[model samples]
Target: MMPNRRRENAIIGLGVIALAQVRSRKRKNFWIKNCLLNHDEECPMPLLPELQENNPDDFRNYLHMTDACFHQLFALLSPYIKKRDTCMRTAIPAEQRLIATLRYLATGRSLQDLKSTTGISPQALGLIIPETCSAIIQVLQKDYIPFPSNPQQWQDVAAQFQHQWDFPNCGGAIAGKHIRIVPPPNSGSDYLNYKGFCSIVMLAVVSATYEFLFLDVGKNGCNSDGGAIMQTEFYKRLQNGSLNLPPAEENVEGLNFVFVADEAFALGENILKPFPMRNLTPEQRIYNYRLSRARRVVENAFGIFSSRFRLFLTPINLAVYKLNHVVLCCCILHNFLLRNSSSYLASVSTDEDPAVSGPAEEAASRPSVGVMTGLEPGHAELPSQDAHDIQQKYLEYFVGKGAVPWQEIVADYLI
Candidate 1:
């Protein structure tokens, strides 16, 4: 009986060995089929020629190149970001995340698609996008993007305005644009209006070179530009004399010599507006025309931003917080490009021709009068007498200064 038991045990052991060998062989076969072999083993996969590949779609192309652009942008932004605990822990290594977000914004690609193409996990991608945008905005608002700091810079900018667009002593052009955003998760359909759906207001300031200097975001889509401005820290600074501004005598065009907005903004002592009244005198018409020519810089800047970051042109389906980051990131990239001349600015034309293919055409098409949509209706309606009074003030100011006639400058550029 003992000999019989031993023989049975040996037989069982042999059967187990046979089963293990079979499983090992199956695993090897699987690896071979999937081409997972090391260099010692030949891979039997076929190689395809590069030219034979199909042209990449816009999304793919954006993902491919944005990887590089974001890297450089983040490197410039890293030091300031590292200071914050939240930024340090969760920050999307600036280059990778920022580029990815820009690619998404520029192309309006799905987050899943971006994850697949960029190899960034969807969850990480989501977190990185907003964090990077916030970081970029902080960097731009703090260090890189300047807001007419000294009298010299303001004078230089004003000179550019006079020389390039024909308006003299203009500090910058200011305008407001509504960036379309997804309604809050629980909001009713009535909240979404004729502009499709939107959430934030972009109140931007553009330099004479058409560079975006200040981009303030996150105001409710329901709010007016004036409301947004009133609520901003920058506006508060302006109100409190924290922002060092040139004196009233140096005021160019009108309102303390600061070229602010056209009819969209309310006319004030510090902010310039076009001929406010319907019947304009010859001098007021010239000032209005010249101011229109100069103020187009901000309009062109917005146009360029929207056109290049096509995401702004479309409805953003991200969370409200994420949408704010997206807007800021786009603005940072816009300024970075303007400063470095390697980004979108290189492709833009500086020629005075209104027929240019990019932002110039968009700027030309925007209305010269009336309030921009997404504002409170009564907020923009200026009193006619006040408008006339403002116009008279500007005419008196311009004539007193003996500045070159605005029409000559406009004619030079238009011709």
Candidate 2:
């Protein structure tokens, strides 16, 4: 009985070996026919497909990929980022640092809260936020902002404004916004420079398509818009006559094509403003209406910028010097989104006219363009005669040219 049991076990082992040999032979034959012998034929063995679905929308849904998106953005921007050797030696990996920083910006979570979510320590998070912001600003200042390089580019931008917003020969819309920041350490009266809480000033120009044409950061909130504009590099260029803007054409009432701002910016002949009147003439009203309609591009641009950065939506707890870097980075990303069609502006309802009231009441109400409000802090009011003269001149020019009526223009182009 013992011999029979041993023999049975041996037979079973032999059967297992025989089955393994058969399977091996089959696999070998399959490989030879499909992969080796038929070299010209496509391999039958399944290959892993490349993952091509890493888009911003999809990546934004997942935490890891969201992290990766920031990583990729920072990686592309590495060369522009500057850091001290001491900081660099102790710094975390660039990719990790960037993702963590962006996560903070996007979510507005506390640094302690971010530790669990981003898997970074609180101390590392604090350092990474400022460092990464600095790097982003350097990259953006170097690469992204579109300061018109030539007369032709400026003309092209003007043409776009004319076609899209019916503001013919206009350069861009100028405006200023406050960016909240962390109060500086030992800041007393200096903190008073920022309004409400710690904050900085951002002055920007928005193009016809509601994209940021130029943005400058680091002005204290207490500075008047006029003061900030005077300090801007763009303004410096204009003052130095480095920009090749043509002299105002006689037909356009000798108004050189340039960005029109509120009364906050001191106007020479080039930058035009409407007559400041408690009441305006029909033609003056129409001209102001058109100008206001066109200038809404800047407000919309700021709305989009704030929505994207969300960090600007709330006060940040960072030093004033670091605040400048943060503002710069946000503006750079704003331009990138505009260029790439990845920004909130690209997805917004461009059809809605910000100047118009309710569309539902349109049938009952004549379309009335809203009036321009206060000038930037510390700017002189426009004289009524000068405003009326400018208005009449522009209106007559538009009427003579049979330019699209503001209402028709809004209906056809804006909607």
Q: Name the top lDDT candidate.
A: 2
In model 1, which runs have C-alpha deviations exceeding 4 angstroms? 1-71, 77-98, 138-141, 149-152, 188-196, 250-255, 346-378, 381-390, 396-415
What would you estimate as the lDDT of candidate 2? Answer: 0.62
What are the RMSDs of all candidates, in order?
11.5, 18.8
Question: Which prediction has the highest TM-score against the true structure?
Answer: 2
In candidate 1, how many Å is residue 175 off? Answer: 0.9
> What lDDT does the true structure give each of the candidates?
0.61, 0.62
Cα error, candidate 2, residue 55 (Å): 10
After superposition, candidate 2 runs with Cα above 4 Å error = 1-58, 61-75, 78-91, 191-195, 249-254, 352-376, 381-392, 406-415
Error of 2 at 116 (Å): 1.7
Q: Write the per-residue lDDT of candidate 2 for residues 1-415, one digit (tens) a residue.
A: 9999999999999999999998777444331222222322332111101121434454463222233345567567666543434632333345456666766776566788776555556776788788777777666666677767777788888888877777777878888876666767776545344335555778888888876778787776677778788889988988788877655562245645757776566654446654464465555555655666677678767766666666677777776777777777777777766665443444455543424644333222322222211123665544456554554667676555635434543333323
Clashing pairs in 1: 70-95, 71-95, 181-198, 251-256, 251-257, 252-257
